[model samples]
Target: MVLSSSLSHLALLVSLSANNVLAAPRPSSPMSLSMNLKRRVPEARSADDISAWAANNKLALEAKYGNTKSIAKRSSGQNLIVNQKADSSFFGSLAVGTPPVAYDVILDTGSADLWLASSDCADSACDGVPTFKASDSSTFQNKSTEFSITYGSGAAAGSLGEDVVQMAGFSVSNQIFGVCDQVTDNLLNSPVSGLLGLAFQTIASSGASPLWQTLASSNAWDQPLMAFQLTRYNNDSKATDLEPGGTFTMGATNTSLYTGDIDYNDIPDNDESYWLQTVSSITSQANSISISSGSSALAAIDTGTTLIGGPADAVAEIYSNIPDAEAGTGQLEGYYIYPCSTTVNVTMAFGGKSWAISNADFQAEQLNSNTCMGAFFSLETGSNAPAWIVGDTFLKNVYSVFRYNPASVGFAQLSSEALAMNGVNGASTPSATIGSAAATVSATAGTRDANSAVALFHSSPSTTGPIISLLAITMTMFISLRLV
Candidate 1:
């Protein structure tokens, strides 16, 4: 190969210039060194193998013994058949006087409290709908169970009762659930009759097991876990809600849902509720989470929250990590941003392993200036303290499932084939393996606060809902789950 005389001279000059920059007698500017140092760090994951490994291992845990546990043996599971549906399938409603007015219910793992449209409630808080009346339902069995859940914005108080729940192609006989009697002014849309607490346990009663917990303990099915998903209602008023936009499953993952490799963790609690993990390490910044399914917030990975809550500084730091994320002035919530040409890489560490957000997970809705907008979770700085919640923004990115045995942990992302849908078994094969999640939630991804919320959690979600204080008095940080 031959090069022109000018080209050769230019190349020689560039080489000499670079040598001078690197080998200068004195040190270069700190900013210049930082740029070079960042460039030198190894890539977080390999494009060739990471995806394949995640795809394979991605098929989607246990405990018992009070607040703590010891792995005694693999829990033999119940044998109930597992059936699943799409987000737009499972439907519910509030019946005032006439035939029950049907409404869709959002089953969330990110939260533990459950509530729905109530009949006795009346206020602007009730989103233009009929509340549930105890006298209307053919199946409302009053148990005199009192329930009250608080939130960052407000609270929802109710009672315990049983109802006829029709889903998963199977009817639950006298399914026990929470019936809201009073109303909170901030509740998004109302007529919310009652909430079905799928959690294995509830705090309403001292040392009381939840309805879902009772079912799991009884081994009503071959497995102890339940799987669910909520259809994204991308509007202020969701007309599609009156139709069907949610799903609840007993045994496996719906095939129509996005399929990937699954990672599993056993709940620290032996029952289906109380999803807990060991914080491999903790500091004063952000907790590292091994949420292998997709990138969300550290908060959503938890099951003890109703709304996403966290430290203000950390939220600001997270937003600042991305270029062009403006500071929140008055009402504007800060968000991450990147140039159209820039590839955004977000990742978290769980169970001593680090995972990156896949390309498909990077789907974005471009706003302007060739920028994009999306949030894995809305963790604003609560006036109280720093807490991270994995809400809808977080959970929706991954297919979350609960596991009851073998390890007594919550499982996510099932691989069952014969999953039911539209109230029908629409598949050919039965489920092979149920997945588990990291029982150890770490704080490696970021720093922690001087005062952090309780490291212990049972479950939580990212919508507007009543708050559950997972914070232990020892921790002194108030982390609340706001109900929707």
Candidate 2:
């Protein structure tokens, strides 16, 4: 989730020589810190699994608006035999402290802050996950500032600290981050220690410079930019939880991962909290209906989110153009379902250059013989919320770049090898045995108990104030399965 805040500027100071002559700046080089990402795949064997996933997301949304609720567990005893690959997240390794204790963290572009589970974290969510032992680090500095961050799904609260953080051969000294002693079940899941936020420092809940910003301000990169090339499994049965997930590069773009020129889109000056941009239009070729248009159709390009989300009205408009696209009810209230055979060729434009979404990425899961879930969901709408949230559903189609100086997001067509691996050229239709799955849904009716409220408190020797509000509207994590 992205939080909004007053934007802050970063200034670089140049020092002069003893002769009182200004020293020449170093020549820019094409140096890059690159690494491979690992994907986490969770299998969903039945419709109940899919419903539970969607329900979890709904609960998170409610919690974000101070309406935390208990999720109702609904089971439609329909045995839908399918091997649905629910690839949930991608993470990579980074180290902290003097000896560099390694931990796997999700490279998130949506939020700002770097946090890891502490050895004192007794929360069940921290079980089986690695924790950071501050005593082991010689350069660790406990700021004694109590901090808490509320996510759409979960929350974490602990004290702030500064340490040496290393990633992909690049080390950032005296980087301020969170050392969580308390966390929710969703905070530090297995195989994922924490998150490395790549967004700006303005949206940081801890009120500290993010890891990327600290590195950039220290001149750790040849270029002040980051690029990503996310990989897809296409529902490969042999794929494991730690499958190859493409590349993550800092400083420069990888030409081999993409083709043609990169299209750079400007981020609005006022909306620099997240990597937000104006989406010119969203159109569906199947029904020839313009689902959304105009300058107000803004979107946040986030890597932390799994699927695409839009305003309820825009989501309904999108499904209106697809034949037999029915709105989901019951446990899947905020989702949409359509005929499995329907070809949903959806394309979106940023800066008037349209990018096509692969059919494999458009549909989520096959609920029954003829019905399948759509990847796009309805998010809470308001004056502060972005109209759309663009996640992996759209990002996997292009080579994405996040620049810092000018603060622009860039996209390029995937290379031939990348496209072939994603099944873009000749993707197969979803295959499923639909006789057992429920084909019809009733009106939305379910009881929800509010989740735990976000905890905020200040302790002794605190260096920062308590978090007063969220920085931006962030979508909860979404997990789903589908036959391919």
lDDT of each: 0.31, 0.56
Count of clashing pairs, candidate 1: 109
Q: Which ten residues in a row have the lowest lDDT in candidate 1?
A: 31-40
Any runs in candidate 2 off by more than 4 Å, and if so which? 1-41, 59-85, 286-296, 423-484
Q: In order, how many clashes per candidate?
A: 109, 12
Q: Pick the candidate with the highest TM-score.
A: 2
Q: What is the TM-score of each candidate against the true structure?
A: 0.50, 0.74
Tens-digit lDDT track for model 2 on 179-269?
9999776555454566677778877888887766654544444556767776676444445434445556654566667887778888875
Residue lDDT tens for model 1, 261-296: 445654333333334332222221133323212112
